[model samples]
Target: LVTVNLTANTDLNSAEEFEQLVIRESGGAVVRLKDVADVVLGAEDYDSEVRFSGQKAVFMGIWVLPNANALDVLSGVRTELEEINRDLPAGLEGGIGYDSTVYIRDSIDEVLKTLAETLLIVVAVIFLFMGSLRAVVVPIAAIPLSIIGAFFLMQMAGFTVNLLTLLAIVLCVGIVVDDAIVMVENIERHLSEGMKPFDAAIKGARELVGPVISMTITLAVVYAPIGFQGGLTGALFREFAFTLAGAVLVSGIVALTVSPVMCAKMLKPGMEDHGFARLVNRGFSRLRDIYGRALDAVLAARPAAYFVWAVIALLCIPMFRMSPSELAPSEDQGIIFGIVDAPANATVEETARYAEAANDIFFSEPETDFSFQLTQPSSGFSGMRLKPWSERERTPNEILPGLAAKLDRIAGISVRAVTPPSLPGGGNFPVEFIIASTAEPEQILEIARTLQQKAAASGMFAFPPIIDTKIDQPEAEFLIDRDMVASLGLNLRQVGEDISAMVGGNYVNRFNIGGRSYKVIPQIQRAGRLNPDQLESIYVTGPDGRLMPLGAVATMKQSAQPRSLNRFQQLNAVKLSGVAIRPL
Candidate 1:
């Protein structure tokens, strides 16, 4: 085949040109292309359709830039979506279908609050034990320097301030303060021995250098194995482990470099025993005496201490057996999606109606910020975002049961309300069951439906389990009579070509008019090909060069067939998935 490029011109700019273009001269009369074929404007045919919640809809995904801040990106998207909703035509709506950052922001805020409270507690404990404001100041100074130094290293390593990294920083708050505490306590001991402030600071730091280095290295080593974990576990925790190790290492450096200097400048030659300091000292001294007496008693009753230890060890078996285990905890992000599936042969318009009805249930709730629906032929999906936690009394979890009940009341469609997965890339449901077999599709579907019913009846899941199997779609089958074709002087190949060209249309040729090439497809008019009955009236060129009716040579029948087939491990399979009602 040879290919050629041609520039489009004004004469053939529109569909009307197909009707005007000359096909050939027949019997010395001009025969336009329309004389033998139909030319009309219609939408391009689509082969693939998207369905969510068993409803027809289009899929859209939003991506954040590599260097962009997630919180900032989320804020911008929310603002823009709000603006878009305002400008949308009446009855149109928009909403976020799935947002990963919602949980990220919430987790970070809670972690930060915990870090602040922890810092306050640590400072108070230091002051109470040391009984000197100067001694307390030394450890407090180390906190900010170490944390800020971790941030600097994070920036250098191109790490973003995400949930895992922030968690690492929170843990470092406790671990990093240990080095400073050891240094200040040693220096205070020297001060109590009547040494000068400068001499005590130098000697105290020198004496603890070995121990400080050992402690820092030991903590870092404990986290090092986490960084080396294999597969997905490694990918998720490596950043967290390394960030914590870096913070501890930096804290040790700060203690060695700046801690002694601060102590020398801030401390007085002798400890002051007045006001809060004297009271705190007395309280700590009494605690030490009580601890000392308790320790001596334990040492003297060695057999009783061993018996108590054995009892504690025996109790651990029940505790271990009773505790729950899970891969990841569930998260509520104030959003949920309802998947809607109609019968396989349903139209997009029908799916849209079902989706809109489901959306009405969500919109009726006071907690809903907004609701949106999407529909494709045979299936549809709806999503809604709830008001923030501060504004709403109930969470998505609380709202879900009511919403599911309401959705169940809707007729002609199956609906499932699913929460977003806890971990990124995890499946939508907490558990998925795959039934693989070499059996026929009908048998596989029967098994799947039975499993779904049993699962729903068990009351162990949030809703009825979804059976992932295709429905039978309506199809037309043409049974050609070879005897009738031969009697009518009709060739089967010619009849097929003519029918295909007239009904389904054919790209017979291409033309150019405006620097772009356009295909020329000619088919029977919509009025002539609107229904299966019209197939009888279609004309086919027989071998005798005479026009023959298609109905005379063939018959059409309607039946149902699977719309799609899915396989797993080279075997036909049906899948079932649902969220567990109780934590597993």
Candidate 2:
């Protein structure tokens, strides 16, 4: 608030101004804020805290705008972070914790490289067979245009450029150009029979239109079931199936229309058989003669061929048994989460110290870009992001073994570096089991430890199996005497309240200071509450208004107990989890 007068004016808009304002006045004296209470600048109390790399820090998340390009958003965010880093103080830094664009870019780039290599192979094979450069160009030109045309259909179907769709396009590089190749081959056949280029193209396309449509429909029907599938399979492959079907349909159209027209315009009456083409033609001719001889021999000795095929089929049984199978292949996502656990009785600060030691080791690695640490009372987690795939030689999977080794050496903490599962509704590990028991927690713990040890000794797991149970937290039990309390004129409630106030702080009331209200809580000083022996000094009031020592009414003993209890289907359960050395 601001105060104004005709001759004088004062601005009192800041908290300091309000704090310094006088609240009471007397003769030759005044009661300002300093007279009644202490006023010092400090940070406001927070309900939650965040720690990174074992140091207290703030965490922030950036979300891409709806419908915005992911690469563009990532670029903008990276640029802003660079600028922010420049302005930060020395020894302070900022870095990306997670970036989806890395995986998306890598997947697309690999698929594109595969697509290009496939195109080259297809072109080379076509040239080797036809021995004509002009005929090869027809299929090469049809491939791109047909694939691009599918994007229009994809747009209409509300699909975006993603891994599945790009994969479909890559696959279409071969399938989409099939019809065009057939058309060109037939046109070449007609040309060899002395027909004109235009007439040959028209006759070739007319004869193959029915067959091309039939082939396209057959391929489309194969993928139609994929699009209609339910559950996870359908959700994953719907885009892939539709994209391939659309590309095949477009190619069929191009074969009937653009292919014939282009062939008529570009293809010549005959190909020159000389130089490289002549050499390739000679090689192909020799190969064809050998194939013809082998086919005739196979037909004459069908029993021998059948016997060889039968032996090969029998061998396939053992081959299949030896092959590894998995629901999803593991992908290196350029990040790994290290879950660190301290003893159950450890404080948050102690856990943070352990996390810091682990983080130091992580940062020392040349491949690590940055790391974020989260510490709780007895557990902590470190999320370490590696350098980009293009920048680093080793992937997260390749580096996990070394990192886990270093983290395992950190004292007072157990750390496990885990790559998140590719699929949802599962733990990070490949194998997980639950041990349910109706017995006591001690028996359950013993059984779980025995099973974990057996599993570890089997040498079938990448890491020792971990049991999800904790029973190391420190506790104290107080045995109270009701008769002694009643005789001392002190009730149980009074004793309870006194103990609570001493340990947990007693909330008195609320009061205002500088226009802000605050709760007032007072408790016993640190030295008075440090040991169980000190409990004897804590006094409770009796009905006679006399103080009675708490030790006279209760006996205290130390013990250890489980931090938490877990149940499965109304029965206590211990969860065991580990990664398998081989897929199961």
**lDDT per residue, candidate 2, 1-584, as tens digits?**
99876664364434465468797777978888656555434333322345664467877877787678888889999999999999999988887667778877887888888888988998888777767777778888888898888898899898888888989988888898889989987887797799999999999998998999999999989976898898878887888899999999999998889989888988876463655666776887799999999999999999999999999999999999999987687887888888877887666667777777888988878898878876776776678888877788988778888888898899888888887666543555678888888987778989889988988899877577877887888887667799998887778888888788766655565555678775555456556876667877777776587777777889888888887788989999888888765577
lDDT of 1 by residue, 366-395 (tens): 988766566667776667878788999987
Stretches > 4 Å off in candidate 1: 1-11, 15-42, 45-60, 63-121, 498-549
Q: What is the C-alpha RMSD of each candidate to the true structure, in Å?
A: 5.1, 6.0
Model 2: residues with Cα > 4 Å off, grouped in runs:
1-56, 60-94, 113-129, 272-279, 422-425, 436-444, 477-502, 505-553, 569-571
Q: What are the per-model numbers of colliding residue pairs? A: 19, 0
Error of 1 at 448 (Å): 3.2
